[model samples]
Target: MKTFYWLVKRELWEHRGGFFWAPIITGGIFLLLNIMGIITAEVLGASHGIQIGASGALTQVIAEMDSGDMSKVGILLDVAMYAAMGLLIVVLGFVVFFYCLGALYDDRRDRSILFWKSLPISDASTVLSKVVSATVLAPAIAVVVGIIVGMLQLLILAITLSFHGVNVWQLLVLAHPFKVMFNLIGYIPLYVLWALPSVGWLLLCSAWARNKPFLWAVALPVATGLLISWFGIMGLFHLPTRWFWTNIVQRSLFSVFPGTGSLFGGTPHNAPHIDGLHALDLNTTYQLLGSPDLWIGVVAGAALLAGAIWFRRWRDDS
Candidate 1:
């Protein structure tokens, strides 16, 4: 347990600079864009009011928007939320990819893995540390960045709306930091679970990479899935490649939350269940989690993680 904690802490310490500066960089970019947006909107509103011979009418209209108009405000807030979420996801994915890619490679390059191997830690602990870093620690950092960015986005939105004369008290309340943080806490475990497959692939790559594993890590599975789908033989092996794509792409963490009955509006609609199976109000995630495809993903993930550990334990270092 002590060794495991050290391994985790050591990985964090190495990457702390990147993890710390990422949010600051992202927030800066987002803040700049938002400020420009506010300026553009104000100029547009002023011009619009001038065209109607009401010098300050547009400003007054912005100020006069009441709670009843919260729906409109909500739409704008959603835009900001969506953009920030997208940026956060991209950044998180890249960080995970790079971190895992570097973990074993860096150790091997510096003969640091040998030093650790000489320690009392087992192979399981070595691989498990990487897994935990990818699955838990890396994502946790990204979530924190997301929350900070989200809060800043919310503040910008509120201030922009106020400048336009919109009282965004209710909107601000909905975007409260504590509420968002708690909601994130509730969601993290599920997200980690959902992301396990990718983390497993990353671990596999980190273990196996010689030159450029990211390219292969991404392309190999995609190519395999395509070939299997094209041969129409996935059914023979019970490999539901199509279903895996849908769940990972559509239903996974960092994806949009589907509103009622919508199911992301992208997937083919299943027939409305006339049976008892669909009567319950379980979240759409029920379908994602319960799908045989996701289980297959889990099995594949387990295999990958196991293979990584096996390879690291027995493979020649030369």
Candidate 2:
């Protein structure tokens, strides 16, 4: 148990810089935006107050002139804000993915896997620790950073509203900030499950490939699938081609987890190459379990994991 924790800790310590800098940068940007929004709103509202008060006719004309336009402006603002947030979150996910890949790949490239294998730890523990680092620890750290940034942004917004003579406490409470937080909590688990296959493949690729694991991992399967399909179309090795087409039911290992969207299911994102592909539904899940494709991923995952262990175990340490 301690060994597992130590392994995970060591890996995190090595790569903490990448994970730690994102929230700080994102939060700073969010804070700046919130402050600017508050200042702009206050200035605009104050500038228009005298004109609005002096003539009801002028006020009505001003409202009429911009009523529809205001909504469009608001929508644009919302899109921009969400886009920024989404970009931050996406970067966080990317950092986590690449960090895990780097960690796994680095050890192999540097011949450090053998050093760990010589320890008392089992292969399962070593691999599992990296999985924990990628799936759980990384996300946990990112979310905490997000929450802190979010709270700081809210505080700045509130202060700005107060200065502008608007009470925003009810708005804040009604927004159910805590409920919003809980919803995010629910999303993290799903995200982890969604990310698992990529994480696993990253480790396996690290273990197996001597160089450029990313390129080969993607290119090899795609090349194999295409060749098989071409052969099937040509009526050469028809059965082999048919089996290859059928068994690639899911392109990503993440698809094997229950409740992944149709994007990863049965076909590669509904591309034109695979004709007669059905949208993945609950039925597709059951069908996948019964199908040869799921079994192949299962067997392949097991074999890769076993091979990673053996590679670590028997590889030259000197």
Best by TM-score: 1
Model 1 is weakest, by summed lDDT over 10 consecutive residues, at 253-262
Q: Candidate 2: global Cα-lDDT? A: 0.56
Candidate 1: pairs in clash: 62-165, 63-165
Candidate 2 lDDT over residue span 1-318, tens digit each: 888889989877887776677756876777787678766866797787733223445334434655566545343433333334454566676676576456556877776766766788887778777767776776667666666666666656555545544444633443334543454454555445445555556667665667787776567666777976765653654456656543442334333222342344333334344222122123332343444444555556555566655654555533
Against the correct fold, how does model 1 do in TM-score?
0.74
Give the winner by lDDT: 1
Misplaced by over 4 Å in model 2 are 34-85, 225-307, 315-318
**Which residue pairs does candidate 2 place in steric collision?**
none
Estimated TM-score for each candidate:
0.74, 0.65
